[model samples]
Target chain A: MNIQTKSQFVAVASITSELSAVMVVAKEISLAAANAKAIAFRAGDKAKGFQPITDFINELAKETIDLVTNINVYALSLYRLTVNEYRRTVAYNKFDLVVKTTEGVTYAQSMQAPLENAKISMQNCQRQFKRDVKQLLDQLEAVMHHARAARVIAANSRIEASQAGEYLQSLQAVAESVDKAAHTIHDNVQRCRIALSLYRNS
Target chain B: MKMTKIYEGSYQWIMFGRDANKPSNIIDSNQYAVRTANRCLLLEPGGSELFAPMMAAVLHHTPVDQITDLFASHQDPDVISSLGLWDQALSNAKLHAPAIWEGYLRHFGCESIEYVPIPDNGGTIKLDSVELQLIPAHYLHSPGNFHVYDHHAKILMSGDVGSAVEAPGAPMYVDNFDSHIEKMRYFHQRWMPSNQAKRAWIERVRNLDIDILAPQHGRVFKGDDVKRFLDWFDSLQVGIAV
Candidate 1:
């Protein structure tokens, strides 16, 4: 009920509402990417649907930043490290997903043989998008946890919140771990795409 | 009063009334409360200039649920004067106090807020982490005046019995008794000059191990000062038991 809690809740509700939109956009981009890959598999020649997915993914990234800023404003700073780490991972992964999906379409346009193989590569890129979205959702969950704990801290000092501080620290550690894991995946994929680009041109 | 870090969570001690530093005209003794619980509680919130400040502070502590409990030590306007504003913000918190003081709570246009009368003797309220016990203060200041006993903090927030005339910025705790004894005596003579009432309340206080003494008008007395104040009050006689 305190001002901090009230303000934080309003921001949380805003984030939740905004997340619905993000999810919808992400789903559209995924479907678009899938459709583009499906066309390349059938005809081995279309690259038009690919650009829309990349453009939409770009918009999603911008929206993601706006969401993070809102979270930071209402944030408790308890999970600052976790949020920052996840932010990096999500940003990197989203960037990788966009680059890879775009490259898969380019790969199809330039290559003549193994058309189905190019579609498979594009499908893998879409999977990367899904992975990044999951990471973002995980980060949002951690932020919500800290927000709730901060609310308890604001409402009354009588609460035993030192324990909650420990929990928040653990949340950061987990986020860092997830970030590192995702970073490795992202980097390996980026290098593979570079090699694939070198092999197939358009 | 030197506002100490008695306790604050996500809720900060926010003041919402106008010129809250000034002695309240609505209530003779001006004191403001910072409400941070899921359900904020207003103490002596009044219609005077203090109304807006109390609302702002309460608003800071209150979100969707509104005020949980509207509380006052007695029926005095200074204590329950702002009941009107609180009733509007958190219609469900309800106005609660002794039956005798019920009229004053209702006096603030009892449309939205529910009025609950505590037995003349006492009542217990369970807040989120703390429990509030209301003990009758009898005639120390008003008929319905009662001390709010916070068990966790070991504090007894008496209405006017402990207000001092020294600088308004007087310390709540008395690390040095001799330093504040004069001011304490001066205040007791003017405000709580009833020997019988003092004796009765002293016994009531003695039954509990009080760590702090938070008077409505002055600073809270903590640690040794709390014990010493009681001993001093025990020795004094006020106006032939009148």
Candidate 2:
């Protein structure tokens, strides 16, 4: 059975590992893009050069890192906030309605930054490009295409936020799971309130 | 404290890697001061806290001017980023190193130190009693990396090879060979890095007849365990399932 706490810890660690790799990749890519920028600025009507080739490869690596980091950070945040809301109900032994609502609300808020960053990086694919050259321009164009795709996927972050409301359907559905314990609902609410304040204030 | 085993070379010994238990602590990296009778050499002592934490360990006896050559095994932050920082500490420190990672040292701003290039075609240098053999072990961890050996001590500073991600109070040397081999076996199974690159370097290491293998990460490998670790390292495919 997938308990909430175990699921959250695994999610966080996985996100951290993915972020670490992306950070390394981003640095590699940044180096490449910087080198390519230096070369394209100085190509001087000469042949297509190895100097820019270094940059292009580095940029490719960075772009890969950027996409991974953005999504993971955002997703992990939502998961953290959403589940923290329910920690009280599990404690008071009230596996009922109110606890389910707030968790769903928290899950939706965590993805804001990653979704935004993905859009910004995709835009950089064009902003960082040099115009009018066939070879380098074509390569940048390909990079820009992928960046756009990332932005499109991140557009769904808001939709995920909207789904948060529906997940809190404990108003109608809570009576089914905890119906036998419905008589104790008043006691658990007070317990839930005290626990939630301790958590929120922290 | 146990007797400090002094390596006869000029090592700056900049420390790096997973260092720091407290919130406001310097990074966890150590610089090696490899000394010889006539001269002293400094190895990669990472940049962040090289002077405060690392030099505090060295400066109790000697000053920076005594250091002549600076050597970095590779371009890792835990390995060599402090080349520039060490140069700033010593006025006349020259960098003696492999050619592969020279650009990175320069990138870290080690312009004051003169670059001593090692010829890959094969060469040897004697710093008095200690004979230094520059064995190029590229891609065992990263590209352009090499390991330094002292035939006198029968020790090969193996860089990142033969490493284990052990915690504090971990054994430095094992008395029982079998249990030690298991540590190394598990270590290499997960972290040998690049296979194609390690194969060629393993061949070079086989010919060296080393006694002690001192890697940067975890415990140093010695005796029959050294051979066992090498054999285990050789048999496994590069990269770990874990």
Candidate 3:
């Protein structure tokens, strides 16, 4: 493979791997969100103030999962497009040898009746690939947005858990776990965006 | 694809193809490369399907970037289907083919290589130190065709001109000229398309001093077989298809 193709492959692989990491974080935060809800329910009247924060955290976890799901779908498309383009590059290299063989003048050099159509098609596919990459970034950004909001809700839940004397330790532990998961999800999303910037020149 | 050294010295000629791994459906093709110290010229590198194996075979001999020139006798799929892939691999290489098929072959996605168009009259290329002739062999099959000639080796890389439609796993060179006629006769008759053009090409090639008449398909013709082929081809009526 050419250097350009190698670099592009590495970039795409990095983004996909980071997105998978984000999925794991989302899943963990969702479990923590559920646990926070259970704790709030058990605390009954004492944890009334904590109920709203846990509800908000639960909603944000679901939103993050939904956005990440969409991001994964778009990333899969991006991977396929990138692989197709690389194959095109490889095919182009092999056929070039026919012309290199003669080392003379070619008759119908510019006459690309079929190639013209293929070029247009390839350009369209490339445009779609770019648009898909942008859409994936948008989705990642949306997930990150929710992750940040969840972190804020988790902080509030921790404060409210401390106020509820009965289930202070369990409520604070779930809140702490939710906060860490959200932070991890946010960091992974940022990594994905950086990885995607490698395609800017494309 | 396999690369076998046909000649070795100050310059070299390596034959690639007749790949066992090639799909059963596609016609088998032979690809050749002429390598000098500073440059290597690839001849009729074959279709896109042959690209990976052919490159693997070539890489076993030389680095991909060392290939500086590409030559296609015509626009047939078996002749030049791998143009796009080569374009990606050898960005510094240039393609030389008949001027008539320039626009047509470009459809194979030739974006990088600079095209040095060959006129109908034919021309010469300097491969580092060796000067090779692009002898015109138009209408042997395609409307525009060429054959590469190496005077030092006295070898004629006859594109489709002396090609034979042999079955799979056939020998690389003709050992019996009489039996080989069966493999070549129908292909020349139906594909050559113009008896007048055939005779003209035959008359021109007859004057050249060739020890090995190497064609794109079937086998190479050597020594007496060269003269035997010319005499036989001259008498036969081609372009018989209506």
Best by DockQ: 3
Per-residue lDDT of model 3, residues B125-216, tens digit only: 88989999999998888888889998888889998877898877778889999999998999888888998988899899999999888899
Q: After the best TM-score superposition of candidate 1, give how far the Cα of residue A154 lies from its true spot, in angstroms.
A: 80
How is the predicted docking of candidate 1 categorized under the CAPRI scheme?
incorrect
True contacts kept of 3: 0.10
lDDT against the true structure, per candidate, is: 0.50, 0.49, 0.80
Residue ranges of candidate 3 with Cα displaced over 4 Å:
A1-128, A132-202
TM-score per candidate:
0.48, 0.47, 0.60
Question: Model 1 segments beyond 4 Å from truth?
Answer: A1-202, B1-4, B8-37, B168-176, B240-242
The candidate that achieves the highest lDDT relative to the unseen native structure? 3
- Write candidate 2's Cα lDDT for B1-242 as tens digits: 01134333343222223433312333333345565544666556555433334443443334445567666677777676655445444557677667766776677657568877765533454554556777887766766777887676667777778766555545555467656556556566565567887788788888877777777666666777778777877777767764
Top-down lDDT ranking: 3, 1, 2
Cα RMSD over interface residues, candidate 1: 26.8
Model 3, residue B32: displacement in angstroms?
0.4
Docking quality band of candidate 2, CAPRI definitions: incorrect
TM-score of chain B of 1: 0.81
- Model 3, residue B85: C-alpha shift (Å): 0.3
- Candidate 1 Cα RMSD (Å): 27.8
Candidate 3, residues A46-118, lDDT tens digits: the string is 8889888877777777777777777777877788788767656444443344335323333223222223443
